[model samples]
Target: MPGNDVRFLLVDDIRENLVALEALLRRDGLEIHTAQSAAQALELMLVNDYALAFLDVHMPETDGYELAELMRGAERTRRLPIIFVTAADMDETRRFRGYEAGAVDFIFKPIDPVILKSKSEVFFQLGCQARDLARQRDEMRAMALHRDQAMARLKAHADNSPLATVELDCDLNLRVWSQGAERIFGHKTRDMLGRPVAGTRWLSEETIHLLRGWIADDEGQDSAPRYTTEAIAFHAGGHEIACELYASSLCEPEGQHRSLTLQVLDISERRQAEAMRSLLIGELNHRIKNTLANVQAIARQTLRQSTGLEDFDRSFSGRLQALSRAHSILSDATWSSAPLDDLIADQIKAGTLDGDRLRQSGPKVQISPENMLRLALTLHELGTNAQKYGALSRSGGEVHLSWRCEGEGLVLQWQERGGPHVTPPVRTGFGHTLIGASAGGQDGSVDVDWQPEGVIWTIRLTQGVTPVSGDAPVQKALTSVTVTEESLVGRRILMIEDEPLVALDLTFELEDVGAEVVAVARTLRDALREAADQMVDLALLDGNLGGEKVDAVAEILSRRGIPFCFVSGYGPEHLPAGFRTVPIVQKPVDPARLLSVLHQISVTPVAETL
Candidate 1:
């Protein structure tokens, strides 16, 4: 009700007196109803709610005191404030009777308007306060009803959700458990409710303790805290499963009485996917590293005794293209072998030998993967050599490339003519080694007859397993460069590589440049122990070791103040924050680039005595 609804009743046997009383007690927030007699006043009291009643003491049949008594008898108006105004000579006895008849106060015949109105105002204000209190109580009840309905809906939704929901009290004991929680943990709510989480074997001892600490402590945070982690959980039959937990505290908006809500999800499939992903990653890393090692070998061989970069670029690209073609064919064959014609066609395009100057006749034969790559590179090298000085150097020159099956084997020959005179190279280059390796298996041999008019090169292969080969032409020692001047001379290096071939290639490369490899580590464990125990000036590391990150090993090396570089197919983004400053080398490494990096970290001593 509005504040102006505070009503008052005025009564007297005289009409003018009733009007006078109404006017005297009038206020902006009060509605006054006047009556000239006790009967009309009683009727008004029954019809309307009133804050106070003003009545005259002297009346005909029933006086103001009697009406007040009547109001007091009825329960509805019993507490209403009543004030008596009278002209009769007043004494303490009459006042006592008025007070006993439920009169709150008395006014004399010549009423002091100030005292009447002030005293009347106090009762009006109390009635207003009482009304406001009752209204507030009703509104509070309504709001509480709505809040309960919303909570019921939320509880129903949470119970139906896939995530396991568990509620814990401030004492770290389970209070409420949902059906979803039972589904995940394999226990019914009846057995677990009101129980301490620490008592269950669902979580390990350490995890249980961790949870207790998290529940009781949020680092003194004033708001509800949240935490997420992956850990082990047990099934109803005692089988352990991987699960992720989302933990949080719930309470009022002001952050009181925090209760823990734990949501669990089964991560067994995700964990399995992660494991498979790791295995694939390791296998991919192995393939890439091995391929890179092969590339590295090819680079060394192609650049062997080269005079300049330009002189070697064409040779190296041609060799790499041949290797790519061989790989494409082998990949098509599922790494089994490559048809001999496919390789020849690849070289014909790569060597620019597709015109009349090139002629060929061959029966298709399947060469094993090892022999296929070597054969491709060997043919490429021969073509490049011929282009520079042999038959292809002259306008009238012609070349014949042919192969045929012989007694349980194959014979391939390249005959050149009508060009500059032919002569054998003084020292064996990459070409010689590649040809030798292509023919290295099972009585296979490569022969070059250098004649004045041309060169006749023949390669024979026996049918059997083509053995895996290693390295290009062995690097020649540089007598012109001394130990004191060599960049890596006397430097003890630690190598961490997961692939065997890549590791060996890197080690051989380092040894060729005068660096002493102190130890080789293939796993994080081995890397750490090696880093701690070995004495080395520098280290080489792979980004991943045995399917784990190398950052921990890198951290150890960093704390020891030993410099290192990462060499892996995994990129620089995979490097941890603390190790981002370190150098990185991707797979299929460029030999010159590797050399430059090695040189930057190698040990160089100046001649002090000289």
Candidate 2:
């Protein structure tokens, strides 16, 4: 829009002549103005530029020659092209007069239309070229300004960046060192510049040798060939730092290597942080496994101890809740050892002890996590018995619980008073076994005295307070299913179990009985693969494989005419409808019955065997 529009001038005494000229030169961008006299033309010329002007030579007042001379006299209009037009015959005097008046050319009328148009187009093209040159000049200035700003920004980034940049020449001499390099290496740029790279010791011996090998070999690479790798280097202050380096040649046009750039980034902090995180994660995993093993033990013992689901819900739930409380305290300390006071305080603070009726006094004794869990559970049981039957049941009752670490071991005494007469239980129970474990390791001992006035319990377990190495005792519940090794002889089993503990037990028991296990699948996909890909005989499938039902696996086995049964803790209805006759052994299954079922399915008549 700005570059369009060229102004034009036409000076003629006759209106017809002006109209004819305007029509010939008229175009979308040309703005042709007509003047009837030289005085009016002068007025138009004073206001605007004209790329080309057509002036009539003969006039009564101030002729074309005079007007052209006047335009040449003005500063702004001097470059304006004047073309003189005449109906008169060519004469030397007239041409001489026009040339003397600064006219560019003279045209004799009637005009040759082609020459007239061609002559005008030349001046128009010149005007466009002049405008383009001016625009180009302005653009070059803007580019220079931007280049300066960019250079300043690059300088600032290099100064503030954390990564080090070093330039080394072909002779292995440090040619340049950036401000970032100075900051990271704890050395000034002046101290590093022009120094020998090999002597710097920043590059390890192995890394230096690797770099040298790369440099010595000519791989005939393209422009900007480079190598990047991570290695360990020493800081200026004598500490190991992990650095990532990028090396490239600063070559000449002939393709000979001249120098290299080592863009070093320090990653020591990041790697250290990652290592610490990994250690913490591994510790957390170990603790979680321990907790899970404890839970498994509690579940089995609770089930064995209870009469029915209602009794289990009433009794076992409370016991597990007690264990959960102990876990919470340990978890708060990141499963590390907690003080003895906090261990015992957790039960009483959780409403086991009436705030006004319990008295506690013990020197601060630090207990390991393994002993802490057992001790917490024991205190919980004692408090439960006290509230239900002993001292805490009565308003006038009280409990004085204390512990002191002596030369023999840490001795804990629990004494209760002012309650109904106490009677000894007929036989030992799970609660006694759990409390007994608190005194020492799994082999710890507990002593209980039932007096008419109240009850007294003494525990001895301090020497073996370190962390437990093996699993809980009740985890051995799976061993109750007994089978002779010869019972399952020559049986081929495919085990599909997701639970690791259950899988371990099944593998161990089945292998002990001389079964040749063909495959063990942990996922439904794996089960399907085993069914389709492997030779499976008498498959054992869990009801759930990682949260998904093993419907597809079951269908595959059934369709293949394979004798497969399910071993799960679920009801028979949980299985697919097609295999109604397939025996489903509920979990905690007797190994003898499982073996018997496999024996029955694998049996063949004498005629069929032949």
Candidate 3:
């Protein structure tokens, strides 16, 4: 709305000439004003801004040249462009006179319409451009004012923030120190400004060295704009604080260091939380591996006692369900402890035992997670036995389950009544073995009384009970598995693992296939030494050895041209980027898969294996 101010002036004594010029120049975004006399033209020019004006040379009162000279004398119309229309033949002397009178150009009596429109269009475009430039200048001034206000607000916020804001020069002299830095480091801003940072008490010597190294390395290099690092800083009270520093630097065009801005955030609480999360993850990993090992043991034992596939399915599934139920209870309590009554109640509900025919009594007692698993399995075995051949087999049968604390120990009794006569077993079975194993790894005893009416089982534990290791010995008929590959026989192998039970199980599996284990290294130190010193044809490398990555050992084995495979509790993401192509076996290790991988490694060429 503000830029549409284009107007043109045409002055002539002849009405026909003025009409013709107006018709030629008339178009959109322009206003044409016509004046029949010099006086009228001068008055029109005084009121309205004009882009261009045309004058006739033979006006009655004032000629075109005199009108041009008069317009040039005026303040508003001096810079305006003027063209003259004349019929008389012009000599060099007359042309010079017209030029001196401020006439820019002269058009003949018969004017060309093309010339008139093109010349007027140029002046119209120039007017539009001037308006646009003026508008842009005003907008830029407004933006500058807003930017100054925003910078002021940002400075106030930085000064009051909890994070320490620091500005340093190329020589590491403090240039700007906010109030936050004063509060955190016990130094006034006025005192800290213009001081060298090397003598500051807030930063330790080691931290200063680290920061200086970063700055020096980046000084003359085409470095990134910003960087982040962690450091141990001291508080005003002399207490230690973990600080996370974010730094950005300004540089000259030639890569010379200029200035730097640093924002230091106290991350002590975040660091503690990260450490706790890591500990919880490691503990969870340990427990999961143990659980898998226990499952393997249960499957193996179940297989040994099973008479057929159907019997194995029934027994193994029931045992696993019982274990799952115990895990559920532990999970609900965050794996800290499980109440004995809750365990018994869940078992009774799962076993579908009649509550009216049972007498159950026990004080509130908390058991460890591992012991709860063992107790759950023991209860499953007893319930299955009772439903099959013991008291629960008859309608009139009854069971009495009671427990009480005895001097820092606990004693639980399971008795059966109102059933057929009982006799002692000639040999122990899987049920008997599991029930006996309920004593766990503590000082405990299992006693049974084979009365004429029924049987009674009493379990007493002298200390906190823990589930037995999966590698524990058991007296049972052994099942043999035939070796699938003859290449594995008599081949030497090196094993790198930390868990004793897992290593032992692997050792037995390798031995069963006639492969000799040359060395078993549990730590990174031992693993590196064994890998370099041993002359084994192949190696079994675990991805993690006692919380240290085994990438170094893998590299050594690769350099020696030894074929190898990895066994890890974690997935491929845990593997080193360089050794991701190597074969990996995850826990709990499958005997067949481990053997298959070993056979492949033994037979394949070292170049291909690597």
TM-score to true structure, per model? 0.40, 0.49, 0.47
Query: At residue 228, what lDDT does model 3 achieve?
Result: 85
Q: lDDT per prediction? A: 0.76, 0.75, 0.80
Question: For model 2, how does the per-residue alpha-carbon lDDT over 534-605 read when each residue is reduced to its tens digit?
Answer: 775678888889889888888887777677678876655667766666777656554555666666666633
The count of residue-pair clashes in candidate 2 stands at 1
Q: Could you report the Cα RMSD, in angstroms, for every candidate shown?
A: 16.8, 14.5, 16.6
lDDT per residue for candidate 1 within 1-610, as digits (tens), equals 3543678888888888877777788777787888878888878878788888888898889998898898899988899889898998888899888999999888887888999878888988987886678779888999999999999988887788878888887777888878887887788889989888777677787777777777667654666688888889887779988988898876745666457788888888888999989998997798779778977887887787568887677667566666766776677776785677667765664434534577776655677877777677778778777878788888989788887766666788989989897777788877677777765455788888988889988988776332223422121211111112346777889999888899998888788778899899988889889988898888888878888877778777777777777786554566666666566655655444455666654533211100
**Best candidate, lDDT-wise?**
3
Model 2 CA lDDT for position 579: 61
lDDT of 3 by residue, 267-336 (tens): 8889999999999999999998988888898899999999999788778877776787787678777788
Report the candidate with higher TM-score, 1 versus 3.
3
Better of 1 and 2 by TM-score: 2
Cα distance off (Å), candidate 3, residue 146: 2.8
Per-model clash counts, in order, read 0, 1, 0
Task: State in Å the error of residue 563, model 3.
Answer: 55
